[model samples]
Target: MNSKPVTRIKKINMYKISIIGYGNLGFHLVNHLSETGHKITQVFTRDKTKTRISKNKIDFIDDLELLRTDADVYFLPVKDDALKEVAKQLSLKGKIVAHCSASVEMKVLKNCTENFGVFYPLQSFSREVEVDFKNIPILIEGVNKETSSVLNDIAASLSNEVIEVNQEQRLAVHVAAVFANNFSNYLFSVAEEILKKENISYKILLPLIEETVRKVKEHAPSKSQTGPAKREDDKTIQKHLKFLSNKKELKNLYTIITDQIKSKK
Candidate 1:
């Protein structure tokens, strides 16, 4: 035999995974992971007959006590409030337990298992909409090096961009995400309402919105800024506020956001 070391490279390091919650985020992970040849050994959901998950012939148990401890990983993508309570129900010893909460730290799963981590995907997920996770950035944090390495590999397999973040940094990222995604979307809803009042088609604003997003991508958001608020045009601002005089709450929001934008200027 030749004295060459045989280096085995795994094409797909398949691991048995159990999903605790079948919500949007959980659904996305299970679907993607299952497609990649990783075995979904078990699922703990309130409803077992749910569409995509039902296709997989796995042990779909509604109770935690029925969960098999043999799976390599247990993914908890439940609501932030229920995470601690759910963690208490599971027997996750000797398994890598991970949660998909941006706000909740890895320590929440401490009672569940010592080998726990945070597998937070920095993107809003909807089951009705398809998102290519290969492009989405995934953030992971583990309690130790072994857990970290395992989580890192798992995340890197799913996303092109994988980041290791501390609890503090993750919370900061969450705050930014709320502003960038949630707040911006709410602003769009407000715009739609205002346009509807004037019988203007919301579709007309789509191009303008698309172009604004494109500019932000090409340049920094601060540099790409346009509109009256960016210019601190009090005349235009007062006119818009007067136009929104009927919707008192929305008018207040408009005033607040305009002030915030002017402050940035």
Candidate 2:
């Protein structure tokens, strides 16, 4: 009797990628992409000297002229305001060009390539902080089905949560994120400022913040609401407004938010 040999299948297909920005999102994308066995051919930044040293030996270039055209995907993780201008310089006709902006439309890359799309990560990114790529929701939008499939495969390789979203849907998610993440963070900063004025440590709010987030995770934010505004506690709300009286801007902001919260209830 003769024995048959077995063959192994590669789960993730390797892609050659070129990142056009070295900012926070770009930095993390580069690290994760490289770690996932993708070959980063080049990385572009305004000033390569200012960026942290690359351990992946990625060719960092300042000039767009130096950009290599060999990569399969060109990732533009630049600021939303500068995404268009930076993309205008690229002339990769057949290669896939993608932007990581939550607000920007995918049509911005229409003229750049035939296979252009968006590879937006839902979570906020910062250069100093470390995050797990697998946990983040990657929202992908391609010009067509074939283009979308390619992006979907790539996004799946990086994240456990991958969704195929259209421009309109992506914009909706972005707006919701602004409310949930950015607005909440700003409120946290306001809380910190209030504590600072009273010579109290902002760390005192950490446990409360954590518990609030935990409750929201298990239930809808509306269902988890337990604040003075949510409870319609006019006395406490008035007291808070009185405390913020010296800071007219804060008082106005508080009033606006309190009214909004109460209205939602």
Candidate 3:
């Protein structure tokens, strides 16, 4: 056999990411990005002593003035109210700047850099809980095609569903998320409270909750609807309202939701 020369493939340097927040979303971003072989140049947080990465040294800065201009993408996962103020402090004139807020407009970063966009990930995050980013929907809204392409590439690396959406569409999805995730979680808490009062474990509702979600997954939520209100069982509804009479707040909530469901029927 004739000897052949070995040709090695050259590796390209990925985007240098700088995360501006250290909250739940920010924590996951750093973990996922670093794990995906992307270089995180720096992380801007109040706590420089705290580090999440074990393999590589990541620069942590508490001051906005210390933010390096070398990063190709700066992700602001800060609070929606403080986004503009934080964006105002950044001096990344030509670098790509994006936010992780679902409701906040992408134009909020216009003053921070010439290339700006939104990198809103549609998921509820908690620092202690591990989330798989493979199936998560990442909504990207860039100012131009260049910005959009860059964001889309980064998002695609982390998720299979990388959607390029406009500000209006993003806001609509955000609202729906609040209703689906936030509101439903709150209702679960209410269920826990109700069960606790009777010295019952909330775990008893777990199977029911799982079944409810399964039903919705298999059919339209409206079509999957059940319960006294949806079935026009006024006697059962009144009995439930009477039981919750002492809990004025719960009673009112129950009535309001019952009426809404009844109206739909």
Candidate 4:
């Protein structure tokens, strides 16, 4: 003991992070943060059946009672429905807690802790797909200046874009996301069904889909608009509507969407 000198622990830029949930977003945050030099001290999940933590040596806790509250930042990337319930179960006190829900505000975590924030990553996450967060926009909001700085540092370390957006702005962005992503995907599904009925592969529309997306990237979506609705072609519209006549919902959806599109033009 006398021969060996005491070595002090380095407290520079590194932060201890405790990630909650084991979903796609949670996996992304854990993997990306670990890759970017942040210390993931704990991983909390509901299901521990398929969880594998080989990249880093971290404490994995599935049970709520066993969750560690010692980390500098605790990330809650769980579903919106599970957020409040988890918050109720956990007693974080003064720890910095954050959630990834697009709709819910940071107030949801008030019961869990006095210091809380929203660490919303504004993009879809998939475990099977590799994500490059270099240019991804991470929306952040905090209960106070201290919480904001902590979240900002963590976000800035891994992402090229970091925005401090309030609840109203975040909700608007989320609604727009649903329109740009989910609604379009649903329309693609409908298109696929129509093509399948005619023994035509959906691959035929792939180029069209890609080009449409590209056009919006280059210019405004309103300016990039095309097709029957944009041109107000009643003949083509009626023809398409008649084809979907057998399905009442589909027909009504087609009419409503066409009307809305035409009105926009």
Minimal lDDT window, size 10, model 4: 49-58
lDDT of 4 by residue, 21-119 (tens): 979998888888999888898898777763764355667888878877678889999999989888888788888999989999799899888889999
TM-score for every candidate vs. truth? 0.90, 0.90, 0.90, 0.90
lDDT of 1 by residue, 1-265 (tens): 8889989955646788989998888888887888877788887888756744444566677888888888998899999999999988877777899999999979889988889999999998888888898899999999988788888877877888999999999999999999998998998988888889899977888999899899988999989888899998889999999988999999999898888898987
- Clashing residue pairs in candidate 1 are none
Q: Write the per-residue lDDT of candidate 2 for residues 77-140, one digit (tens) a residue.
A: 9999998898788899999998999889888988889899999988888777889999999999
Report, for every candidate in turn, its global Cα lDDT versus the true structure.
0.87, 0.89, 0.89, 0.87
| lDDT value, residue 79 of candidate 4 | 93
Report the candidate with higher lDDT, 2 versus 4. Answer: 2
The 10 consecutive residues of candidate 1 with the worst lDDT sum are 48-57
TM-score quality measure for candidate 4? 0.90
Clashing pairs for model 3 are none
lDDT of 2: 0.89
What is the Å distance of residue 92 in model 4 from its true position? 2.4
